[model samples]
Target: MGVIEDLADALARDVLEAQAELGDDRFYEKMSKVLGELSPTTQEAFMTSVRVRLAEKRGRDFLARMLAAKRSGGAAPQAPRGPDSGH
Candidate 1:
């Protein structure tokens, strides 16, 4: 994916995090407010931008960069996993 798609994924993660912080009702209201701030033209442009980004090669490149950084003395943070992962 390209920058736009990466941004969207990051946004989705953020939304999920926010939902966890604020309940479903508040989350909806917050989303509505944030999205409402943008014009319809902006929304359409944003979606197209993300769609183009999603069509690119980004995830693998990003993962490789992160792993390389980790091997080159970067800290390896432990990630949280779901219960189905045999933890």
Candidate 2:
């Protein structure tokens, strides 16, 4: 990755950790606002990193739930729907 991507990724990781530790779900928004004052490109990259990481985490959690339900002979969990999902 390029310098911007690397820096954005690192910032994303830190923001996520801080959000969890501080129980501040809006941390990403706040960080984005701060980044906006710096550079649009950097802010975009950081938001992209944050979105990808969050999506992957949600997917993993959904998978775990599905597996657990299957092991217990329960109905498989429904797939998660994102905001863009028509249903």
Which lDDT values do the candidates have, in the order given?
A: 0.54, 0.93
Per-residue lDDT tens digits for candidate 1, residues 1-59, read 76655654565446545665676724534553465486444344444444444434355
Q: Give the total clashing residue pairs for model 1.
A: 2
Q: Which stretches of candidate 1 lie over 4 Å from their true place?
A: 25-33, 36-87
* Predicted structure with the largest TM-score when compared to the true one: 2
Please give the distance, in angstroms, between residue 29's alpha carbon in candidate 1 and its true position after superposition: 7.6
Backbone clash numbers for all candidates listed: 2, 0
TM-score of each: 0.34, 0.89
lDDT comparing candidate 1 with the true structure: 0.54
